[model samples]
Target: RGGCMGQCWYTAVDTQLYLIAPLLIVPLHYFKDLGKAWLYIMTLTSLIIPGAITNRSLSDHERLYVNETYSTPWCRANSWIVGIWTGYIIFKTGNQLKLKKWQVVVGWTTAFATGWMVMLGMYNVNEHEATTTYIIYEACHRAAWAACLGWVAIACHNGYGGIVNGFLSHPVWQPVSRLTYGLYLISLEVQDDLVKYSRKNLFYFTTLNM
Candidate 1:
């Protein structure tokens, strides 16, 4: 549901992130259509995500986010915990040699499999699709990602040939990952507004959909 050109229109469906925010960001960034005002916001956001996600209290300050957090306890129990753990490990083992090629491959594969399995489990059983669930799920995903990236780096340390390593090490990954914050901000707001609008407007629904 949206006010298209100030006329209220109602719909039962709302699109997801890839379809929604990219629909907005791509044009803004690529076509150079955004006015000078948005440039400052985008630049500020790129700096905010890394640190915002790094610490837990940044989210704890807000009541809405506190309620929305999928991650429980928010401090001792979090993906940020994994981040702390990983950082400790890297610092402790900084001198150690990277994993052997076979070991790296197996580690990466295991990481990917575990990540997908965990996400599926969460999706099926977790009823709270709110902020809390999202935080926990994202934390899990981020931990898995850290493992995968760590292993991939080890795999590519000697030489890079495998498809996974090639893609991971691709020059585009850096830029794209940076934009994830912008994408996150843009998409979350858009989807929230879209869902709220739809839930309110589309009241006279048949049995076809909610």
Candidate 2:
């Protein structure tokens, strides 16, 4: 049932993570270094769990996509934990991250490299086959993607984002951001109904058409 909602599985996973957030957040607020260490451990564990599951049970790409690897909170916690870590860092630093020019350049470079790898590394992998490399990629990809996002958020908040921040923080996005939740909730069902009742076959596919 968790993964059966078409695109809405994200909502379920997010809610599950939200319910357990305080377990990390409360200690993080009160315990300082201990809380940071706990978050780091959890992040490492998040990576390990998916790798272990993939190695032990997932035999193919399709199986990996359909199985708990794609849906379960434990398997999906890498990004969530990364986000928490990012938030904690922001809070601890009072939203002021001062870095050298070289540090900023290195951070941006690393983030972009990780983001690209996560996006394109699977292009050559056989969809019907699984391997140790795929398992490692699957395990690290989500965390890497989240790390990229976390870096953007941190950099933007700290004024290091430059034009990227200008684009992202534009007022034009405010209304769209507000409507995103409603759009996400109904867009799939609306599309399904449109296809079901259409007079002609809906064959043409493109981002704008969809």
Best by lDDT: 2
lDDT of 2 by residue, 175-195 (tens): 899999889888878899998
Per-residue error for 28 in candidate 1, Å, reads 44
Instruction: Output the lDDT of residue 92, model 1.
Output: 46
Best-matching candidate per TM-score = 2
> How far does residue 1 in candidate 1 sit from its true spot (Å)?
26
lDDT of 1: 0.48
| TM-score of model 2 vs. true structure | 0.84
lDDT of 2 at 203: 98
- Considering summed lDDT, which 10 consecutive residues are worst modelled in model 2? 58-67
The C-alpha TM-scores of every prediction are 0.42, 0.84
Model 1, 1-210: lDDT tens digits are: 223322111111112222344533454446553522353354334233433463464445355343323222332122333333344455445647556667756776787787676657466533653555544444455445555555445445545337875877789889899897567546656777899888754468778866
